[model samples]
Target: MADYSQSPLELLLANQQKGYVGIHVEQGVPVLDRDLNLLQDLISATVRAVISRYVGNGAAAGANGFAVQALPTGQNGQDFLIAAGDAGGPGSALVGGVEVVIPAAVTYRSQPGLPALTAPTAAQPDPRTDTVYLDVSLAEVDGTVDAELNNSRDVGVQTSVRLKPVWVVRVSEGDAVPAPPSGHSFYPLASLLRPRGVATLEAAMIGDLRQRRLTVSDMERRMSLMERTLLLPAFTAPAPGQPQFVPKSGVIGQPITLNGSNFAVAPVTVRFGDLPAKIVGGASSTQVVARVPGGLTPGGVSAAVRITVSNLGGAVISDDTFTADPAPAFAEPTTQFSPGNGTPGTQVTLNGFNFNAAGTQVRFAAVAATVVGVPTATRMVVQVPAGLVPAGSTNADVKITVTNPAGSIVSDDPFRAELNIPAPTFATTPPQFFPKSGVAGQQPIILNGNNFNFAPVTVKFETFTAVIIGTPSATQISVRVPAGMTPPGTTKDLKLSVTTAGGTATSTDIFTING
Candidate 1:
């Protein structure tokens, strides 16, 4: 037995004769048995068989040699040889030499944990023809677990099977032929014996060898428990109903209509945007309509209705946009002719924006105005029906309301309808101007009229004998005769007039001289 663990050993096996190579071994033989004198020879024989199967037997027929060696290492230890010199055929060696060289380079390049080759040794004789036998033991196949075994042997019987199953075909004595099986099955050999009767009896079985991991029931249980909590149902209370009203665009004094929907019960609130849509009726959810109140912008406005769904819950539904038109498009009544301050029935035209149609009723300061031009949708021309604004220095406001189909109160303030209060009207009570009728510088002639207030009253003198009153009151005015007017010839008839806020009133000629 060779002490393989202590030092390295190189073995050479050659096919000097034609014979089949086979594995021959016994129980308890150490794979690296250095004490066993013939261990190196056994491993060399195994390697030669493998190489001859791959390459042809006669391929190394010259001075070349092929063999195996055992180095002081593990399964990854270097162990290899090749035929060279006259022992191997020409160009048969991996490099140039008759002696086979298992170079050190080959050993270093081998993968870890896998066997490798080493440097070549001196030339050696062939061992195959001489029957180079080696020893073996059960330990030769160490690290190979029972699980890796394809079949089980009889319990504790110590069965003998080839540690490495292999064989090589032969030719003649002193030389071996290389004929290896294409695959690792014994059936192919049986078929090769009978050429035409060859049949493929071997079949490979496949299965799910992997572990049976997770089951379906486990996943289902996890999914069912997710969000296991129960939830209660939700509810809401009902609310009362209200009326709805919408204003017409660009029309004055037109009432708005109120309609309600989804007000399940009665009390509903109707709002014109922010302002409350006044409900005239007391009934809930009933049609309670009101006029579009005065004072609204001219442009488009919207009405909103919000229903009280519940006491705790505020408005569930509400209309946010609606038109609120209050004033007429046309201007207020304008005074055409100035009537005396005391008199009524003054003529004036009411002018403004949408006053196109005819017969459109115009109200002047609460009094309905008389129509003139057809009040179109745009402009309304009308006369200020008999009315009077109170007397004052400031302009009197004439409220002229128009009536048409296009909703009412389009604008709160349309424009200024000015009605100037005429100054008081005056008339002479007695038609007479006595100029020089009174004694010169002695008696003063008196004039009478009506409507006389705070303004200065003046009398005029015509020539040296004639005299006239410049400003006179309707019932009372005393004008002193000028001393220059002789009563005799200046007793001529003259017209007298009274000046008042209403106007000047004249009387027929009344003569008075210093007779």
Candidate 2:
């Protein structure tokens, strides 16, 4: 059995030698930076946090270079991973704390001895495919930069390549496909249009590589980080002066450690720049842990923004600045959708490059649509939302938007989809009554209406819920009058109504009821 009382992050970090860290200062023990790093790492690994996405979806036009483009070999003399000209600026994404950087696009493979893409031969020209994917892995580095910064040659640099991402491709026939090492980010960009066609078609697999398929060890590690994010730490009372975050720099959603005196208050609010940071457990007068907020790049060497901690004790800003890099996540690729018009339940096809089904969402205006079946990086299908327009109104222009961890993007133009939703109504006033005189529960009442079968139907008598007799048709439905009505009791002027999922319609004529 485990103790449910202790904070999840605290319990995981606890050990025999170190005392509980409600407040590091109060324990008279020195605070360990390693503890902070461990807590932060676990928080970071819970999800594929995108600090910034360097490459824009092909649909997002203008300005930024590195945005995905069509690379057709039929138009080029030599094989290349992307278009030949203007390899757009550096493309970077902050995944958790690791910077998945893409510096200067890898344009041509013509540099003799460099990798080459294989073309489909006349003997076997079945359209071989070659795909371009972003692979991320942990890389080790020596202390060259560290020595330069410290003016000494003795310093250490464990993972220098961690920040410097490599651009790799395949020779289609000669070289093996480049695979991203497990435990990091791997995103698909586009497939080369081989003479040939693209080789080794890959899914738009985004997020943590280790978690593509979870195992026991993977679950344990991920659970720790997820717990920290899900659990919010309660505020300390007595109110501490403005609290400052330790390690002045961090990426968005990364756990940050705060230290201050008199951090005693019931409800506390902390902000990184202008964005609000979430409060996790381990809060005390001397220290509190918080997740970093988005917006604002590093203005100076490290400081990016001012942090303000507000509580009942009053608000105060930290003297020390907290550095946070504000990079936009990848632009979602939602370019065009076909058969523009559709009704509820109609499956509409969408075209784009690279989509993560787990992280992707589709919406028609403000209403979300169901993303059904399997979706490829380049295409997907979604059902038109029933609420595309107000009930009874025919059609509307719904702008389809796609969102993922990187960011959100809308179609270039509005998609005109139909919502031919006609409300249920009687064809005639005081519509035809079946078997005018029969026992209340014995004889059924047949209500004639339009669109009765368009949706599920139900009937109501006054304040009672009536039961339906059988299946409803496009123009009619048979329902039993409320059995509770006393026989021939002369129940006068009862309002009879027909109801569907959309709304209810009361009849202009009233029913004077008798069994």
Quick one: best lDDT, which candidate? 2
The lDDT values for all models are 0.35, 0.54
Cα lDDT over the full model 1: 0.35
TM per candidate: 0.26, 0.29
Evaluated with TM-score, which candidate comes out highest? 2
Q: Write the per-residue lDDT of candidate 2 for residues 104-213, one digit (tens) a residue.
A: 55554533465654556766545444445544544433345343433354553232221234433323342224554444445444444444443422223111111121
lDDT of 2 at 345: 85
Write model 1 residue lDDT over 1-515, tens digit each, in one string: 21234432222123213342333456786553433423444454556545434432222222222222222333322222211234233222211111122222222223245323222222322211211111111223322444323244435432322233322211121222223232211100000111122121111110111111112443453355443211111112223333233332323334455444333233444443334444455523323344333334433232223322211112443332344333345433332222312123344444453344333456656766566545444444455444334443233444446664443332244323434323433233333534424556644566544544424333444434324344444455665555655445555544445444444555565444453
Deviation from native of the Cα of residue 480 in model 2, angstroms: 2.8
- Tell me how many clashing residue pairs each candidate has: 107, 17
